[model samples]
Target: MTDAQEPRRARELGIVVGSLPTGPHNALTDVPGVRVGHTTVADPPRLHTGVTAIVPDALGPGRRSLPCGLFVGNGFGKLVGATQLAELGAIETPVLLTATLSAFRAADALVTHVLAGPGHEATRTLNPVVGETNDGLLSDVRARPVTEAHVFAALDGATGGPVAEGCVGAGTGTTALGFKGGIGTASRLVEGWTVGVLVQSNFSGTLTVRGVPIPADDAAPVPEGNSCMIVLATDAPLDARQLGRVARRAVFAMARVGSDFAGGSGDYALAFGVPGGAGDTPPPDDAALDPVFRATMDAVEEALLNSLFTATTTVGHRGTAVAVPHERVLRRLREAGAIPR
Candidate 1:
């Protein structure tokens, strides 16, 4: 899309999220060897769901898995392969995200893709990580329209660099904080390590930015059970234990964007670290990890804003979800001195 036609990110609108500086793309792809792709099915009033794939290119060669961690803030939804990933603290397949009912199909497709990789002929077992959020508000979710082809397309088409956000992929049919919600990503550089976060937002609460609540005059009553899925990638050489700590920060960062963490919000976060090209670098001292944890929270907070800021109004099977009014938000931020006038 052209510059005028392209959706704008939060930073572009003068809503700077944190003190940290973002990477070149301000996206998950900033981490070396990490790629993101989306397959959106926008059939309008009937269907608006699709699949998103996050491929950690470092998983090939002599390495078959990356140190990974998962955190579940609420467990009200289905997440395929979560138990295995948490138990092993490693991920062998590219992570996939899709609508609620289609999670199983996406997981199956992810397994097929991994097994098809070179040197997997003898592999008898594999765990495919897949996450989901309810998108029935904007799609015919019961139809489970996501097919293997869609999942494969996202995986094979994954690439590095800029990522598409808002109303795409698994976020196509999602809503958040009284506004349209979709895929969003942000990256931070801390202690020479790149920390990137990607989020699929679909929860509800008062919208807040930089401690300022942006009232939603058009706020509509949304369903009770919704969720947000987060994925964090870094080249920090952190072990699964450390990554788990970082993942916890990501889940808590949701509150910065005003998530209620309600009884039915299936808030989840998965963090994985890819080793350096030379080899696995020794993790920094635990005391030095404070910066990494702070950066993770900052990146997660910005990512959640991006999901709301870039999303456009969407009319789906259930009803209409209006996009957050940028001007109104800016005015509120200015009044609160959160951003320069």
Candidate 2:
């Protein structure tokens, strides 16, 4: 495929987000022990949805729940198990993402997966975290095409390293910022610690790239979309409380990418930290969080951009959602001096 005909990440086009150096994969899996997998369900003119799973290291033998935090940028989502995560400040199972109507099933599958894993034979109580974005505009939401098997496939196939992005998994039928949106990921190394972010971009607003706005005609008719889901992982040896604060920064980064956080947008960010990370000796002071916060924001912004850049056009039940016109966007950025001509 030609350049315009193919999909690529923001970094591939020289649209780096911040000054921090990225990990080897420049993705959420760069945090180590974090794996991602997707199960795309594309059945032509009617179905275009799937499942994305984020599995932390605490899911196998000697499995131990990890410290986690949930930050809600907007309260318009049907996020299952949020109350428990908020009250308990941790996650017992792998986090899953899927279409709006399929969130419940995905959560159920997650619970089943955890209960069936080694060491959880007799466990009764479990909280399965699942987040979703409405894909009704592009798919038959009422049909609920995503099934337990699909969720299981995602969970079972997850692996660490580079993750697939855009027009896949839960983002298959999603749109954002007036363009086709999907899965995106990015990571940053802060003082030898890794902070990684993965986003399901479906929320809308003005389409901006490095502070330059694409002309409205090519940026869709209006800033219209419903939700976005952000998943952040880090190996900083932080607890749930600190992760919550860092997660707030991740949500704030949505604004940097032009998210309006509209009334209908269900914007949520879930952050988790591995136990035996660098700084396990003595937790760093809150005063030293400035760099971590900055890194989180920057990674989120780039992840959102990657969601748009790597997505290709799609035609579904509702209508056609075109991918961002990368060449045109780059032209705008160049003229505005965001990139060299």
Candidate 3:
């Protein structure tokens, strides 16, 4: 379907929120050259797991990569290849997100995928950007079932449109705040630019949406073990350092929604800018970014909101179900006069 048709479809499917309109695709892929793919493992009564690949830019051969940055809010999580990205301020390959225990296998598979693809000269050293969240609840983490084939499938299936969320991809077996949480996404427009956020929604604590708490009486209690990995992407020109700052801003956004980065919660953010004119040039020095910085913060804040807004409730193994009742939530917000009738 066309991009415009996608958002209409999302709304029809009861998968949307907030006042801001979405970009062409309403997904991270809406950010120019960004592309997304997923590989979901749905096996019978249980075993909910999957992988997601985010392809930054698909420019023809030898073009410079995107300027990127990483932020570890708590560092209790496992993030592969972050050191190199932080040191070099560039991500030469697609970013992969998956279950925590599948990290090693995913990283290995990513290396193989990159090496086997076009433009590999055998002399190139690969850094596969793989991030994860614990998904032991629904799948057998010890099995290490995810392989190079699954990684490749996700990468090859990547598309640029409204992405599937909630019990899909890396969010298959995730939980948040003692409830059922999976994946969610949202975007914002700042100074004619767009910033988008995609989150693997495995986190803890009472979920608050735009300052309004999802009251315990109104929703399920927070889960005991939870964590989250947030991926932020934008088309704006931001250097690795600036992107790092943007990444931290996500924490504020998370806090605004009531996440205290509680113990046992692996809250992390990875931010990157899409390569545009002149390809991979460093962003303007900090002093010169005063205007851009303001815009970046706004974008980051809104993106976090989008992540929560687009998520829906899901059911997992052993008949465990979590539901984010949109109608009930809207009713609560209306009672508080948070939205117009």
TM-score list, all predictions: 0.96, 0.96, 0.84
Cα shift from native, residue 201, model 2 (Å):
0.5
Off by over 4 Å in 3: 1-21, 217-225, 277-315
Task: Please give the TM-score that candidate 2 achieves against the real structure.
Answer: 0.96
Candidates sorted by lDDT, best first: 1, 2, 3
Give lDDT: candidate 3, residue 207. Answer: 59
Please, what are the lDDT tens digits per residue for candidate 2 over residues 88-176?
A: 88888889999998999898888888888888878879888999999887888889888889999999899998899999999999988
**Positional deviation of residue 322's Cα in model 2 after best superposition, in angstroms:** 0.7
lDDT of 1: 0.89
CA lDDT of each prediction against the hidden true structure: 0.89, 0.87, 0.67
Q: What are the per-model C-alpha RMSD values against the true structure?
A: 2.3, 2.0, 4.7
**Candidate topping lDDT:** 1
Which residue pairs clash in candidate 1?
A: none
Q: Write the per-residue lDDT of candidate 1 for residues 122-174, one digit (tens) a residue.
A: 88998889999999888999999999999999999999999999989999999
lDDT of 3 by residue, 1-341 (tens): 01111112224433234445667655566677788788987673357778988887653256535677788888777789888988997777788999888888999988887777666755368777888888776666666678888899999898887777666788776666545566666566554567777777666666565457775444454543366777878877677788888777765566655566878767778888875522545455667654444544444444444444444444445434355455665676677776654
RMSD in angstroms between candidate 1 and the native structure over all alpha carbons? 2.3
